[model samples]
Target: MPVTEIESESQFTELTKNDATKLIVLYFHTPWAQPCQTMNQIFKTVADSKASDNSISFLSINADELSEISELFEVSAVPYIILIRNSVILKELSGADPKEFINSLNQFSSSSSTSTSHNGPTPLATATATKPQTTSQPEEESEDAVQERLKKLTTAAPIMLFMKGSPSSPQCGFSRQLVAILREHQVRFGFFDILKDDSVRQGLKKFSDWPTFPQLYVNGEFQGGLDIVKESIEEDDQFFEKALQAAA
Candidate 1:
């Protein structure tokens, strides 16, 4: 399906509520944000690629214009994306990372296709019989496992930034400033939103012994928050380059 532009709250409701079987990919953005501009192209590309998939729908809404919709989703940042199926939110991602965005869409497409195949051409009785077994699976994660996951995530990329939101759209002022600094220095980095995962958020405070967010990490080692980053940049012009090199 082609990408659709959401003009009003009613339009958004019409698009999402009318089709319970479609997967709605809602993109909340603003024209003023440079990161949003970058993400806009990526979003369109993903939509175009998935145009043949009748089960998926793409929508772009200006956060500034559609304040009601933004507020409903608590979208305080631009370039935020929410994946919905049957009016239920499956996942929410905040950022302008093309690779991650595409990967997510691909995963969803595969999973949704698989689900449809299983559900399609099935007798009502068989479908009902299998539904209960699927719903019985556990959904809990252990504390030790979460810690281990956090450890791996910090070093998932060479330059990792654990912030309140994404590098493109930051939820907090500190995170916004840190993103600006990183961009100003022309640094290529990967980010994880602490706000999205409570386990990572709370576990990190103890893991790195850093209570505050917008924390920078290079090659798995903890760097300080926004204030320390500013001071480091002031003291050394090549702060980012040197830090990355040391990590390497």
Candidate 2:
């Protein structure tokens, strides 16, 4: 099918949630971004090549026009691509590499037809599964730099959540529940989408010595994951208050 331009969130939802679609290639771009100009053509070419496949669909979203959808995925940059199959994130790619874009679509389109599970795709190759590009790795961040960055991030707000997706659209059940709990308690928190930044995603595991996500940090200290946070609230109704007060 030809690439459909997503005009609104409702339209996007209707098209993406259709049962017939086995693979959805979402291109998030902004007209002002220089990189997006190049990626626009590349995306169209790739989409055109796959036009014969009825089970696969391509969508182009203006990050600014459909702000809610962009924010749902925590899209911080333009010229981004997200592959989805059955509501699960298959892949996320950033930047304007034509070869990488085409190659990824080809890989996932073939796999989407055979994959029966509703779960996200398995790691493409260990640590690089969430890596932004298929090739052309970014310079490694020094350990000290990573540590310093994590330190600032943890304290970026009084309450911080490092989760799989944004608060509005949690990618996993655990993350959704944690976001609900915070909202129930009327807590204001900042969140970092681990899916967007592999550096923070991997570094945070060691930084807090927590191997899992939906991690809650209170006043720059490790609070816990979903279960632990629930337990903390159960133990003390004043848990969030105490944490914020301590920072104050």
Candidate 3:
């Protein structure tokens, strides 16, 4: 079958619950994200190849449009894919890495075929799943390297927010409120979901000496959390504007 665009939550439930479907490939994306443009074609290409196979189904879901489904999978980023089998999450792929998506689909789809005749589908093995082919151990990144990465991430945009979830789907109350504030101010900013990366989540705490999340940064400088942001706005109506001007 061709790739299906899910329009409603009820439709999503009905399609996923189909008894004939042994494998469900879910593509969660938003129109604004540029990476989704590339992954969308990749998803269609692969889905078309297996169009004759009734056991596998591909679904295209807009994260913003289908917020409930995106929330169901805890999807915080666009161009994300989730593989489901027998009501169980088999594997999840993030980002727009075409090779990774294709290889993973092939690996799990073949496994699903074999496992169907036996027991039910099992979750992807976390340990050996993405293990490197080399026999030698891999070297860990140096402290300086990690710091450098954090620096880059902080300045990824003029206004950066390191929060628990995406701006559209905030995982925590503080993050949700912060997003509301930014929107209220009509401020355009970029955000990083710290929940997805433990390294950044933990490293950022030390880097900025801030223990809590929902951290905001202006020009790569630590700007406090939600409370501080509110206070800054209270003190100066043009807080965001001033910060951006300073960066310029």
Candidate 4:
């Protein structure tokens, strides 16, 4: 079964991605909800019926436990189904209707099959998807200025991840892996790319008392570089895991 149970944001990160090739169903819920359990059973039954199909995958994520995914998906109510393909939502529903669920699933399945018939991979239609957080304004906050501003913002969160790129579009392989790992763990970190800011690029070494570009900070404390983070992952230390838990 592609779906088991997602307890942490790390598990959620491993499932969702910017890649447009995967089909994902995110089921968000809470433990104190009796109706949530009933809805989960219904979802499990539906998943069991369609286990043979390899086109899509299922995820059962606890809303209370996985706050990052919950907040990202915005599941204030329990028992919701978010059908996402290529990191975009195609269908969204929150109810106990079996017939409608099956119908929607079938429709997506058919559409997916037809689209996958040709080409190297499923072409993700560009939709000007990302909304710039703040309107692009000209001022001292140029990419250079933003870098300096981002360094201050880095300490804004308990965990700060300063690298060559942001979490989503990493410029280097090390930054990419670190992004994946941080997102997987739902670290709630602030990211800065040295490539964008020359000041922070050179200033961060002295700021965080670290010598590397892809540096990590916990509780506003300097953690280490990519190799250190990778080693933390292997040792099961998950340095930011508890920090996120406490903050959440």
Query: Which candidate number would show the highest TM-score if scored against the true structure?
Result: 3
Off by over 4 Å in 2: 113-248
lDDT of 4 by residue, 37-109 (tens): 7787778888887788776788888765554455455455667777777665777777666677778777786
Question: Each candidate: what lDDT?
Answer: 0.73, 0.77, 0.77, 0.63
lDDT of 3 at 124: 22
On residues 134-174, what C-alpha lDDT tens digit does candidate 1 reach at each position? 01112476778778877788887777778875544568999
RMSD of each: 15.8, 14.2, 16.4, 16.9
TM-score of each model, in listed order = 0.50, 0.49, 0.50, 0.46
Which of 2 and 3 is ahead in TM-score?
3
Candidate 2 lDDT, 104-179, residue by residue in tens? 7778877755453334333221111121111222579888887988888887777888888666456899998998
User: What is the model-wide C-alpha lDDT for candidate 3?
Assistant: 0.77
TM-score of the candidate numbered 2? 0.49
RMSD of 2: 14.2
Kindly report which residue stretches of model 1 are placed more than 4 angstroms away from their true locations once superposed.
Answer: 1-140
